[model samples]
Target: MRSVPEWAQQRGFGIRVEWGRAGAVAIGAGAAGVVVIDVLSFTTSVSVATAAGTAVFPYRWRDGTARSFAAERGAALAVGRREVSVAQPWSLSPAAIRRAPFTERLVLPSPNGSAIAASVEGTPVVAACLRNYSAVADWLLQQGWGTPARPIAIVAAGEQWPGTETVRPALEDWLGAGALAAALLDRGIDTPSPEAYSAASTFTALPDTPGLLRTSASGRELISGGFPDDVDLAVDLDADNTVPVLENGAFTDHGR
Candidate 1:
């Protein structure tokens, strides 16, 4: 019953995966749904917020715009990880935000994940991290989204240095994407793209994910920045079953 154009677009893809902004636009164009995985924090934060029954608004990390953006939405802007405190209600740290007093809505800004998420045009976008990869995969399967005829694009929202346009793929996100890809494979979805297969293979080959994540570059950076707890929280694979899906400009728990 679907229109020709819509069906054509869905049939054009078969489990493609890519990194950062380019993937947000290019791969999102044809895929049935796009999954944005930013394990260092953004997607992880979204998973935590949605798990707590809150909606999260994605915003690009601009110094002055975030406040006004949140104000316009009648939501609070989440602070940086280091800015989180006992009195601070929200922050980029997933562990911290998970414990904060629950708010109905929040605007979370990031240079990578949030930016790519906010920029995605028409495709349904889902946030994924190690904590909720299996949950997301199960949700996708329930939605019948990972079929061979209607593939998904799993995007790793890699980190970008300030004042630069280029982004470097983070190992954490690569593994996060791989984890989701592997989950889909377990459900009988075949990956046509070698990139997706490689990512899944990389994740499956890891024997001690949590131990390894502690030594990742992003993990070390977070630890050095006073968020050692966040790295530990990020590697808690399948810790949650909430799938945060972006809808009407904010991420809310799927099927809610």
Candidate 2:
């Protein structure tokens, strides 16, 4: 088997940052925990749902199988943005989840964020978004992570190109991961890999987060598709304090 080099693994860092599900796997084993950021909506939806006291199950496939997956767990499945209706109010849109009636549990399927969250083996995973990055750092610190002995990796779940498996790195997720990294550093978890540092710097220097999101490609796509509210809700920075921690196959509130 091929080995992940010490440098590639970002060895000796309290905090590390990498992109996509593959990045999670690359740095996951040596780390104490993983933070998954999907700002364009997966983690954002999770923040909104968990803030409402709902348990969220991350599912990798958004298909007919998702129904069976949710049924097996007795959870309501979140669907596509446009698929949301009065009867099926749960969808990937953070706005939709926020407006929907609260369910005890929800199955949120996404190829990016959910895939990374669920695929991390034997590691604590935290769902992070612009709204709850600081809260996630608080939860991690309380749990004694973000040390050299208990390193944490922040995985930015970038979007996939249409009709392809290729990843198209999104700026929002990068900034979201950076936001978390910056929060950790501000709290004295100063050992960050260069990659994590870059992300942290990017977030720290961001002058207009909401404005940037409004003009981002993902934001423009959502707005053009008539889900401007999703974009709005996504950029609600530091507005939430709920940290959704993935435990036993579901994300539960681990807030301070």
Candidate 3:
């Protein structure tokens, strides 16, 4: 664990990868932009929804207040995978969110990705997935974010088990973040931290990303939950150019 100043002094750009809420808070303050990657579903869903011209509001938890929160914002609440149907237009299932009727805004609550995104404050936050890492990397470079003065933090929103206080690092999210880091490294930013380098290397080494995601722990869980289509949607590399950036308590398409 290197200190922040050390990172700033050693590299023109600090490309650090973190695990969950604690990781988000640790690196978020100094980051010019924070890319939250929840490859299993959360960020993937946001990317799909925003690309289809919808705004997404991220909520930390799916509880009793989620419905009112969505209603107050004039947005629909995205239900869990089990609750999804034609009547429930939005859900954590990326496939469902992609095919649902167009919505101007939707409130998506998740115990993992959405929680981490909402936990980050005062930093420009963006959602990234394997499907749109290229676009995200391009957009970050265009904003001059990877330079030393303006570093970027790529946070992998790993899953959490109920009643657990620690983060459960998900392989899919790690690969997703690694893909974005690899994109940045390829674009001429070469100061990623050791952990970041490892992640990038892992992604680059994977010959078949979608195939691996389909068999990962998170992927297997989603498959058992009857949301295998969500995993399929998540692995579509460079599928869209839309970047869902958090702004004014909502995520809207930043780079379209």
Best by TM-score: 2
TM-score of each: 0.91, 0.97, 0.93
Off by over 4 Å in 2: 1-3
For model 2, how does the per-residue alpha-carbon lDDT over 138-204 read when each residue is reduced to its tens digit? 8899989988789999999999999998899999999999999999999999899999999999999
Kindly list the per-residue Cα lDDT of model 3 for residues 193-246, writing each as its tens digit: 787889999999989999999998988988987888888889889998988999
Clashes of each: 0, 0, 1
Candidate 3 lDDT: 0.87
**Which candidate comes out best when scored by lDDT?**
2
Q: Residue 179's C-alpha lDDT in candidate 2?
A: 94
Cα displacement (angstroms), candidate 2, residue 67, comes to: 0.6
| lDDT, candidate 1, 81-119, per-residue tens | 767776666988888887799989899999899998998
Residue 236, candidate 1: how far off, in angstroms? 0.2
State the weakest 10-residue window (summed lDDT) of model 1: 1-10
lDDT of 2: 0.91
lDDT scores of the candidates, listed in order: 0.85, 0.91, 0.87
